[model samples]
Target chain A: MREIFKQEIEQLGLDLVSMAEHMSSAIDKATTALEKADLTLAEQVIDADESIDEIEQRIDEQAVSLLARQQPVATDLRVVVTALRLSATLERMGDLARHVADVARGRYPEVAAAQGRSYDILLDMARQASKVGTQVVELLRTNDLALAASIESDDEVLDRLHEQSFQVVLDEDEDLTRQQIVDVVLLGRYLERFGDHGVSVARRISFLVTGDLTNAVAMVAETSPRNSETS
Target chain B: MREIFKQEIEQLGLDLVSMAEHMSSAIDKATTALEKADLTLAEQVIDADESIDEIEQRIDEQAVSLLARQQPVATDLRVVVTALRLSATLERMGDLARHVADVARGRYPEVAAAQGRSYDILLDMARQASKVGTQVVELLRTNDLALAASIESDDEVLDRLHEQSFQVVLDEDEDLTRQQIVDVVLLGRYLERFGDHGVSVARRISFLVTGDLTNAVAMVAETSPRNSETS
Candidate 1:
């Protein structure tokens, strides 16, 4: 019974990794959809979010069953709880990707970037965000605290690009309409938030490694838009 | 032991209610700060978010301890898991309130609404959001699924107001700067998300009553921005 329980716990971690991989793919394709004005790709990302969400639900049920059946205590119990948190965070990251896709779909043939306005900065943001997604998968799979540092720096890149996106829109003297402005704002927010969730998962990974509750608590606080809101 | 565990579970529910009340007050104050351009009130809302975060952490710690100590199964286990999910949803709601306060603080001495453009819709959004907050408290306190109906309708109202905000910003040819446009967009989103979290809590309550996991799963998907993005 103990051996079976240990395997179930290990399986839970693998499922979280799979969920992260799905989110990484979603953001990659969603950003591509945004970059190229590809409605088909955007629709695909939108449809794929359901599968991501279903995986989250499945993980939740498995985690709950592990707790109920095994009655894991100490380190074992924390593993189950941590899985639950990771699943929720990954699910949210997938939703952020879908929001980006929603912007692409909403714009249809018109690129959300709008004739390459802020195009370079947005591309940079997307690259950094995609990097964070990849890092999240690697972090979950390896449980490496060092990789989390890289994710934090990636998030910083995203934050900088998020700020630059606003500057580009606000300072543009050429043909920037209110609708385009709204799109840029929403897109920057969606992408930046995607990075924030990456940072959050990194912090959760820290908690899992160190068993430091402060890491998780501070993580939740930092992910709040209050910290990221434009000053 | 059984009686003590029951009390602990009851206390978990109460803690969630308290957290909801804090979020309710924060949004109310944050919206008032936006309306009045009262920097003091905005700062207060920002600072109060810490206490809300602390409440969430304390609730989480207590919930985990209960799970470990009692190893609750069946209905008791569901109660604890539901409490964890509720605490998280409420924490996110508080952060949404903090984001609204952040906007108010970011534009100190100048109303984020700026010359009353889209001000009415924003005020309507705030009012509905605060109402949802109140309804969330009632729903949690009473375990009444009927109130969930009211929360869902309130979310619809927020959705409409969210749409109207963009229309107001887009149509207004008078004195709308890019910064103000960005503010309206972010503020609209924060307030709308606040309502979404409220509706999320409503669904969790339904899950607590019915034990139908689909309600909770469907609720999370519905709250994703895909369903709410401006068409």
Candidate 2:
């Protein structure tokens, strides 16, 4: 029975990695759609959100079932709990990406040309975030604390880029309408938050690996730059 | 042994409620400080964050210890797990409030007078959020799903107020600069998100009682208005 339960938990971990990969891809495609103002790609991402939601629900059910049946303890219990938490964060990230796509779809025609440069910066941030997401899953799969810590460090770069994009949008000409600037700033804020969620997942991974939550926050603070150079 | 474990778990629950109360009060004070431009109050909130963090860490340790020693199953397991999740969310909410206060202190003298009306709107929103927070603790104490669902409904008012405040800051020429307006908008966002965290806690309570998560999302969707609101 213990061997069977261990096998089930291992499979659940694989399922979680698969779901995270799907989310990572969705984020990348959504970012691309936003950059190019491609309505078709945006629609694809919006449509894909349901699948992400479904996967999240499935993961939650699986975790609950595992808890009920296997009665997992110690590190096994932590792994299942962490997977559940990570799934929620991943779902939220997908929702944020969907939000960005919706915003892009709404403002496409009006600011397409003006948003070209800004979109590039946003895409860079999204790519960095996607990479971090991948690393988070990898860390979970391999139980790699150092790799998770490194992924956490990557969040600082995303934060810097996010802040820089905010300054770029805000420092633009005063003559520009509020809506135009608001859109750009909102986009930057969304990406910054997406990065935060990625950091959150990495933190969860760290907790699972070491059974210590405080270390993740401490490491993140130490790695984050003192200068707030993004502005 | 079972009785002792149950007693310990109950104690952990009470501690969680206490921590949530402290967090809710800290956020309230922080919001008021932001509105009043009270540096001392803002500093107080910042100082209080350490206590919140400490409580959160304690709750986590207690929950993990309970899981390892008692090996709680079914509802008992759910309660302990929920407590862990709740503390994590509460800690983040406290951090968000502190961030708002930091922004408030950052604005300081320039926003002291002009920010009054905006602060009024924010204060009202914070009050609503506090009510929801209180309701969440009550629901947890009673394990009452009905009360949790009702608290979920109240989140709508907070959402609308947040939207109205954001629009006012953006559309009206309130003697404040663009950065000031952005600061005000971000402050509202934080309060609105505080309400979100409240709803989340309530949802977790509902889940603990009924073992269902679908209804919680439905409640949030029902409360949300037709138009998309920025956070």
Top model number, TM-score: 1
Best by lDDT: 1
A1-231 per-residue lDDT for model 2 (tens digits): 999888888878887888777777777777777667788887787788777777777787788788877777778878887787778788777777776777767766543314545556767876786677667668667877788778777788887787776666656454445555556566666677777777777777777667684765563333223233223
Q: What shift in Å separates residue B104 of candidate 1 from its native position after superposition? A: 1.0
- Candidate 1 clashing pairs? none
lDDT by residue (B1-231, candidate 2, tens digit) is 999998998888888878877777777777677667788887787678778777877887788778777778778877887888888777777777676667656667544324556656777876786676667667767878778778777888888888777676666575545565556556666667777777777777777778776765553343222244443
Residues forming the 10-long window of minimal summed lDDT in candidate 1 chain B: B222-231
Least lDDT summed over 10 consecutive residues: which range in candidate 2 chain A?
A222-231
What's the lDDT for all of these models? 0.85, 0.70
User: Any idea what lDDT model 2 has?
Assistant: 0.70
List the lowest-lDDT window of 10 residues for candidate 2 chain B. B219-228
